[model samples]
Target: MSTEVAAEVVVAPPANDAEEGTKQSHKLERKWAFWFDTTKPKQGAAWGSTLKKAYTFDTVEEFWCLYDQIFKPSKLTGNADFHLFKAGVEPKWEDPECANGGKWTVSGSRKTNLDGMWLETLMALIGEQFDEADDICGVVVSARQRGDKLSLWTRNATNEAVQMSIGRKWKEIIDVTDKISYSFHDDAKKDKSSRGRYSV
Candidate 1:
């Protein structure tokens, strides 16, 4: 039920007017699913068990509309997470698209532009701004105490060329010169990612 319209952005405060229907609507490359998890998860429970699929939006207007209402990461007083992944790709390591995947994590101070960087990352993702767009699985923004983390998930872990290209492109999109590191899910399972990480 998703529309495949060429992406054109014209974001503004959501208006409740009939004229809104007559205005041109901007479309994203594909639908994206917004997910969230609470700070206090049940002990010894399944991963992603608390995740709530807030909404799946395909249009720019829909994205802004939902973002205005429920996408409030800054309001969190405790640890939480906000995930924006491509439609159908749940933000998990076991999904078929993510089984052999990895993530490029950029850790920064909470005092920095966490929200701004996160928004930019979402825009770049839905806008298909990366050369290896298909390689992207999704993005996760973790609101932590020490520092906030922005991790761009990828579909392939062994492809160094592809992973490096994505890492560089993502850093460029976020306008950051600092090096970011990529860690594969498989390596993390073995608790050896510290030595296996690839930096760009």
Candidate 2:
């Protein structure tokens, strides 16, 4: 007696160039640059000197690639920071785009999901989800031993209406029930003891 065996073969259809291209490319409204800072600076170096321009991305795909390559907020050592700002805008209070601006800041303990919050904030800025999108300059996440801080920098600190709206939207997007504060760069630079100009 003889036994017969049959084999099944499965094949994938040919790749579609057009569909592949569409899936691979995503254009953002504005180009953005990523910056990194560490507490240990080069001896005698100016504050901005240690700040490094990491990468710039103008597409969704590029952003994800960079994100994957970089360390998340929770993974960073204490005193490390990550900055994401509009292209051509430095992540410094001295920058022309940020001189007159302010930031909305939210602090969380080590237990908090700082990485998730940071990613949400980055997506909101890049996606133009905020009503006052044009007023935004950048976002920053600072990792500290005690806790982590997330901040959204805006162009006009004195613009009460716009700043308030931005703060509200940011809190909502992050889905944090805790109140966040908004303070002017000038105030923050002048006195760490000064309170935020607005809170939501």
Clash number by candidate, in order: 0, 0
The digit string of per-residue lDDT tens for model 1 on 1-200 reads 00111011123334543466777777788899887775466899888787766677788878877666656556444477878999999998878999999999987544667777788898898889999999998998887777778899999889999999999888988878888899889888787553437898
Q: Quantify all predictions' global Cα lDDT against the true fold.
A: 0.77, 0.80
Report the alpha-carbon TM-score of model 1 versus the true structure.
0.85
Q: Write the per-residue lDDT of candidate 2 for residues 25-65, one digit (tens) a residue.
A: 66899999887876567798777776777777788877776
TM-score for each predicted model, relative to the true structure: 0.85, 0.85
The residue pairs found clashing in candidate 2 are none
lDDT for residue 55 in candidate 2, whole number 0-100: 71
